[model samples]
Each structure stands twice: as structure tokens, then as C-alpha cells.
Target: MANKGPSFGLSRQIQDKINSKYDPELELILVEWITRQCSSDVGKPEPGKMEFQAWLKDGCVLSELINSLFPGEKPLKKTQSSSMAFKQMEKISQFLSAAEKYGVTKTDMFQTVDLWEAKDLAAVQRTLSALGSLAVTKDEGTYNGDPTWFFKKAQENKRDFTEDQMKAGKNVIGLQMGSNRGASQGGMSYGRQRQIL
Candidate 1:
């Protein structure tokens, strides 16, 4: 990627394959969700990979999106836009860390270069999807977009049993626990004869 010159042959193929993973439908969903969350300030991007990448490359909008989900004080301090590569990457890193603290797990997080360099835009989409799912699941009233927009994650279900019920359940054996009622070893023999002690 350092060489901005035109790619060729295998490299071009690889790049195209990577870019192909970008989902246009996912782009529209993410764009609409972001615009709703960030209010009218964050303009909508044209429905395309490059357009989506351009809209969020600087990371300022992402910081705003995540901040808007918070109740009181925002996680990020400064989300000012910058024209430099390192600065942009720094902002992206900050947003990523803030998102992590905001409840997105490390496994669900995307890398800075994934957005900055357009290396894996699908990864960006995945991270946003995870954030949306989390926000919807939390349902703390801070999330701005429509609840249906993001699929709500399932919550843990705990069940408690009374002492009598637990004892009765333990006393009975399930069918899955195989029985030794039949004499299965009657005619079974292999590998040399067994010796009597």
C-alpha cells in the first residue's frame, strides 16, 4: 500500500478481492444508523465503498457517533478533524479504544488501518454492526437510532430450582447416560487372549 502507483496482476486481483467484500447494503444501513445517531451534522455518504470509506476515514464522525451513544460525559475529549495520516490514524485509534470501553469487546473491534488504509472495509462494517447490536441490547435509552435498525443481542437467562426439585432430578437418570444392563462383552475378543489372574 505504500506504493500509491497502480497495482497490477496478482496485486490488483488481491485488492479487488478485498474490496469485493464490502457490502453495499451494509453500507446503507450503517450510514443511516450513523446519521440518525450523530444527528444532521454528519452528512450521508453516497452508497459505495469509496464513499463510505471517505466519510469515515478521518474518524471524527466515528467519535461523534460513539459519543452520541453515551449518557453524560463523552468518552473522547478531542475529536477534531485532521488532514495528516498519523493524526487520522490516532483519532481512529482513540475512537476504537473508546468503543471498547463503551462495551464493544476486543474481538469485535476493528483495526485502525482497516479504516485508514481501506484494507478491510468489511471489518469496519462488522465493528459497526457489533456496536449497533450492543446498543440495541443495552436499551439504556441513550441509543438514538430505531431499535429495529440493529438486531438486539440475546440476554443471559438464569433459572433457579428448589432443593426438592434438584434432588428429584438427580435421583432420576437420563436416557443419554447409556445403560450396562445387557451383557455386551459375552462374545467380544481381540488382540491376543486375556490371561486369568
Candidate 2:
């Protein structure tokens, strides 16, 4: 396929309504804020920061600017339950505490695991090996060196893997040597050979 436009279609009337609600300059700033939120390049930011960010893109306070820009328009009413807000706030507090203790931010949680800027392939390999070793050791199994498994587990735990002592789990006769003969004859056996070599 060649390309399509935005996922959401905006009717001309709706676009006009939105445009009339804010000044062009202010709208541009909000666009910038939204753009940053959608951008993968943006680093870790505090929760709820995006809301204020959209407000601050033009270096203007939200309440003042919104009122000035849309004097006649009513702000969108959000009827959130108090309990939900409390729970969310509590969770945020806990996360902040944990992040402070660990010297990591909530943004770092995604940034660190999903993407890393290592110096070279050697460094990346070293990191991946460290993760693989940790996975097998933590579970008391032989290291299978499955990047997919390691990546999934690490993402789930929200922690990178690193270990000095790790072992591969011992294979049982049932699956390792019995019905799954193809697996035994295929890359599994070849991998075993490589390990020995």
C-alpha cells in the first residue's frame, strides 16, 4: 500500500470548531505537545506531564491561556470518580517512591528495556548475554539463549537481566529425546555442539 492520512477523520465542521476554540499560535503549541507525547524519541516524563505539557508548549499557563483563547467556549467536563483519582494518585506516589529509590523514572522503565544506545554490537551482545544468563539462573534452568523469552521476561519484570552464574535446565527424555525428534535433530543439537566447541 502507498500511504493513508491520519487514522481519525475530522469533519470540516469539527475542525472549524476546534480551530475557533483556540488561537492559531496556541493551537500550534498544543500540536507540539501532542506530537511529543506520540513521539518515540521523547524520553521519560512524569505521569500527567503531558497534560501540562500541552498547556505549556507556548510557555503559557493552562487556565489563563485557555480562558483567554476560548472566552465563550466551555471547558470539556470530565466526571471522574474520586476513588479512581485517589487510586491513581496513590499508584503514582508509589511509583515515584520506587523510582527515587532505584534512581529510575517511570519513563526509564520503558526506555531502558525497549531501547538502549550501546557503543557497539559487542556491547549489545554483552548486555544480551547478561540478560540471558540472569534469566536461566533466576529460574534455575540451563540458559537456552532465547532472546525472545529473555526480552519478554525482562519487560514483564521491568528489570534487565544480569548474572554471573547460570545453568541450562536438564532435558527430560520425554520431550528432549522422545516424540520431539525433529527438535533434537535440528538446531537444538547444533546449538549443543556449538556450546561444546
Candidate 3:
């Protein structure tokens, strides 16, 4: 017997967009993460072999990814109150608008949202993540230090510690250096030190 579920694969356009926007390393991570989230099997598909259906059972995988990438953005929650529903609708509107700006259509987003309505928190998250991913483009770079990035920026600003610099004994801020006393002065003192002959 054949598999009954919808075929898994990304449209050529979406695939192209993803490839262009994300670096190869980041793409691999995304693929791996998605696979881990969606698949029941322990082994994951190769990066090149990843398909939309592989990790997108509903949209939860995408939602989790979005949450991780954009810590400031909150996913829509399932609500019973009418007022909360209104607020959720407003957030959805904003997301759809943003997605439109990035080439995704309101219809496309609505379909995903509708399919996952009244489902668990994971479903809501996945729907939002799908929308968020659609809205991202190459022009808008990712947030700094987001773990989504596979290749991180080079540490060019790192300063090497010299013998004199180490000997200077610069006090670190917010770090407790001595005994664990309740109110002991642990901060670095900026004043000059006196030496006894």
C-alpha cells in the first residue's frame, strides 16, 4: 500500500528563496532541526533530501524554529475569550501583511492557520513559524547570536591577553572573586593601589 498523506516537498520558488536567503550551513541546521521535530524515526534525511512534508506535519516545527530565532516575537495562543480572539486576529493580520511584503499571499497563510485552528500550542506555534519564515528575506539579516545561524561571525574584536595586561589584574564586573559573604565588596575597585616598601 502507498502512503496516504499529502506529498512532501517545497515549491521550486520557496526552495529557491530559502537557498538564497540562508547560508548553506544555516540551511543544514534548519533542515536537521525540522527533521528532528517532525519525524518519528531516529535517523534524519540528508540536507539535500529534505522536503516540506518531512518536518511539517502541521506547522509546529516551523513555529518552534521561529520562536528560537526571534525571541522577542510571541506566537499566537489558543484563546476562548472573544477579546483574546480579537487580539489574536489582529496579530494574524499583521503577520499576513508582513508575509505579503515578502511574496507570501494572505490566502496561503490563512489556509495554514485555518488548518491548525483549535489545535494544541505546538500547532499554533508551527503556523506562526511558517508565516514568519515566509516573511524573512535576504535583505533583512537575522538577529545577532540567534542559534539558528550555523556559521557565526568571526571574533575579530577579541583581544589577546598580554603578560602586562594579565598582571594589571583588572577586576571583572558583577563577578564574585573572594569568599561567598552576603554583603562583601566583590566589584572591581577603580582607585589606585598603594604599595608598601
lDDT of each: 0.88, 0.32, 0.42
Q: List the residue pairs that clash in candidate 1.
A: none
Error of 1 at 19 (Å): 1.3
lDDT of 3: 0.42
Q: Using lDDT, give the best candidate's number.
A: 1
Per-candidate alpha-carbon RMSD to the true structure: 3.3, 21.7, 19.5
List ranges where model 2 is wrong by over 4 Å. Answer: 1-82, 103-197
lDDT of 3 at 11: 58
Candidate 1 residue-wise lDDT, 1-197, digit = tens? 38477789999999889888888888888999999889889899888888899999998899998898788999988888899888888889988988888888898888998898888898899899999999999888978877887789889999999999999999988999878787576667877699999
lDDT of 3 at 98: 43
Among all candidates shown, the one with the greatest TM-score? 1
Model 2 residue 189 CA deviation (Å) reads: 70
lDDT of 2 by residue, 1-197 (tens): 13434334566555445334323343333334323322433222333323333322221122222222222442322212233434433333332333233233333232221112111222222332333334434453322333233333333446544453222233334453547434544444543445354
